[model samples]
Target: MLLGVIGDDFTGSSDIANNLKKAGMSVGMYSGVPDNKIKLNKYNAVVIALKTRTIPIKKAISESIKALEWLKSKKCKKIIFKYCSTFDSTKKGNIGPVIDAIMKNLNVDFTIACPSFPDAGRILYQGHMFVNGVPLNESGMENHPLTPMTDHNLVRWLNYQTKGKVDLINSLTIKEGAKSIKKRITELKKSNVKYAITDTLDNQDFDLICSGTDNLKFLTGGSGIALGLPKVFKKKGMLKKSNSKLPNVKGNTIILSGSCSLTTNEQVELYKKSNPSLFISPEELIKNKNYHNEIIEWILRNSKKRPLIYSTTLPKKVSLYQKKFGSNISSKIENLFQKIIKNIYKYNFNKIVCAGGETSGAIVKALMIKELQIGEEISAGVPVMWEPEKNIKITLKSGNFGQKDFFSRALKKL
Candidate 1:
C-alpha cells in the first residue's frame, strides 16, 4: 500500500477513504485491526478503522500502536492518524495520546496536528479549533455526551493530553503559502517540538499544510488533509484511476442512529416527519434485553419510507439515562443496536445507514465486515460503501457532519 491511515472511528475511516478514492486511488476500509490470518491485498490506500475515539487513553494508545505496526507490515511509506475534524476530545484524550504513541513507535521526532475541514464548517485558527464560525467550546460539541470539547484552544487541550511540547503554526504564516509553512515546521523541529498544530482557514490552507508535511513520515489530522496527500502521491506516480463506483442496491432501507450530538438530534427529528421512526430509550434497552425484537417488529410493520430507529434524544434526557443507567449506558445502547442490525441483516436489507461513529463501528464489527470498497459521497465527509461479495450497500455518517435533513437525503442517494 502506498498510504496507510489509522482512523479513530468507523465513520472517520469512511471519510478518509472517500476522499482518497475521489482523488482516484483505490481504497479499502477495514472495521478494526485486521487479524493476521486475513489477507490484505495491495491497494493505493488502506484505512484501519478503530473504535478508540472516546475510549480510555491507555487502550487507545495500545490499539493505535498495534495499527501502526500492522500498517508497517504492509510496507506503507506514509501514515496518517485521522481524527474528527471537530477535534472531539476531553482533556485526557485518545487523540494526543494515540499520536504520541504512534510517534514514539515510529521513532519520529516531529509531526503535524491539524483537525480542520473547511468544507464541513470546521476550521482551526490561531491554534484554536472552530465549528461553523463559533469557537469549539461554544459549539454544540461542548455538550457532547462523550469527549466533550470544552476547550477551543488546541494548544492547551493537546498539552494536557501529552507530556511532550505542543506548539502552533499560526494562520498568518500559512497564508504566505507552502514554502513559508515548511520553514516554520523546520524551525519548530530544531527547537525540539514534538507536535505542532497548524491553523487552517480554507482549502488553500490545506494545500499549504499538505505541501509542507508531505516529506514527513507521519501526518496527523482530519480527512481533509488526506485530500492534499493524494496530489503529492499522484505527482510521484503512486496513483491510478479506480473503479470507485456506487453499486445499485435494491432492497428495503433502514436508517439507524446512536449519536446524541446536537446535529444528530436535529437530523432524527427531521427524518421522523416523513418516515416511521422508533425512539430507543435507555429504560427500554436495559429493561428488555430482547429490545431488538421490538425494532424488527416495528420495521416489519411499517416498511414504507424506510424504518428509522434512533437513540438520539435531547441533552437533558441523555444526561438522565447516563445518570440512571450508569456510565455503561452508551455501551449498552451500542450492543442493542448491534443486535437489531444483526437480526435485520437476516432479512437482507441491502441499504443500511448508520449515523454515529461508535454506533457505526459496532454495526460493522458485528457484521464481521473486513473490507469495504469505497463508493460515492452522500454528503460532505459521508459516503455509501459497497460489500461486493454480499451485495450490501452501507452508508456511514459522522455524528456532526451532515445537515438537518441528512437522513432523508441519504436515503434518496441509494
Candidate 2:
C-alpha cells in the first residue's frame, strides 16, 4: 500500500477514504484492525477504522499500535492518523496516547497536529481550531457528551495531552509557501519539538502543509488533508485512476443513529416526521434485557419506507444517561446498536445508513464487513459503501455532517 490511514472512528475513516477516492486512488475502508483474513493487494490506500476516539487511554494506545503494525506489515510507506475535525478529546486523552504510541512505534521525530476540515466548516488559525466560524469552545462540540472540546487552542490542548513539546505553525508562516513552512518544521525538529500544531484556514494552507510534510513518515489531521496527499503521491507515480466498482443492491433500508451531536439530533427529528422512528434509550439498552427483541420486532413491523433506530438525543439527555448509567453509557448504546444490526441482517435489509462514528464502527464490526467498494457520495464527507460479497450497501455519516433530510435523501439515492 502506498498510504495507510488509521481513523479514530468509522465515519472519520470514510471521510478520509472519500477524499482519497476522489483524488483518484483506490481505497479500502475496514472497521477496527484487520486480521489475517483481509487482503491488502487490491488498493493503494487502506483506512483502518477504529472506535477509539473517546475510549480509555490505554485501550486506545493498544488498539492504535496494533493498527500501525498492520499498516507497516502491508508495506505502507506513509501513514496518517485521522481524527475528528473538532479535535474531540478530554484532558486525559485517547488522542494523545494513540498519537504518542503511533509515533513511538514508527520512531517518528515529529508530526502535524491539524484538525481542520475547511469544507466541513472547521478551520484552524493561530493554532486554534474553529467550528462553523466560532471558536471550538463556543461551538456545539463543547457540549459533546464524551469528549467535550472546551479548549479552542490546539497547541495548549495537545501540549497537555501529548508526550513531548508541541509548537504552533501559524497561518502566516504557512502562507509564506511550502519552502518557508518546511524550514520552520526543520527548525522545530532541531529544537526537539515532537508535535507541531499546524494552522490551516483554507485549501491553500492545507496544500502548503502537505508539501512541507511530504517526507514525514506520519501526518495527523482531519479527513480534509487526504485531499492534498493524492497530488503529492500522483507526482511520485504511486497512484492511479480509481476504478471503484460494486454490485447493485436492492432491498429494505434502515437508518441507525447513535450520535448525540446537534446536527444528528436535527437530522433524526427531520427523518422521524416521515418514517417510523425507534428510540433506544441507554436505560432500555442496558437495564432492559427484552429491549433488543422488542426493538427488533418493531423494526420488522415497519420495514417499509425504511425505519430509523436511533439513540440520538439532545446533550441534556446524554448527560442524564451518563449520570445514570455511567460514562460508558455510549458504549452500551453502541453495543445495543450492534446487536440490532446483527439480528436485522436476517431480515434482508441491504441498504443501511449509520450515523455517528461509534455507531458506524459497531455496525460494520457486527456485520463482519471486511472490505467495501467506494461508491457515489450521499453527501459531503459521507459516501455509499458496497460490500460485494454480501451485496449490501451502507452509507456512514459523521454526526456533524449531512443535511437535516439526509436520511430521506440517502434512501432516495439508494
C-alpha lDDT of all candidate models, in order: 0.86, 0.87
Model 1 bad stretches (over 4 Å): 35-42
Tens-digit lDDT track of model 2 for 192-228: 9999988888977777888888989999989889888
* Model 1 vs truth, CA RMSD: 1.6
In terms of lDDT, the best-performing candidate is 2
lDDT of 1 at 375: 78
Supply the TM-score for candidate 2: 0.96
Q: In model 1, what are the clashing residue pairs, if there are any?
A: none
lDDT by residue for model 1 (1-414), tens: 789999999998899898888767788888777777766564788999998998888888888888999999989989999999888888877888888889888899899888898889999989988899999999988888887889899999989988788999999888887888889988998888889999988877877787878779999999988778888888788786686466688888889898888899899988888778998877887888667887788887776568999898877788888899998998888888888888878876778999989899998887888778887788888988988767778989998889898987788887
Model 2 error, position 112 (Å)? 0.8
Q: What lDDT is obtained when candidate 1 is compared to the true structure?
A: 0.86
Error of 1 at 10 (Å): 0.6
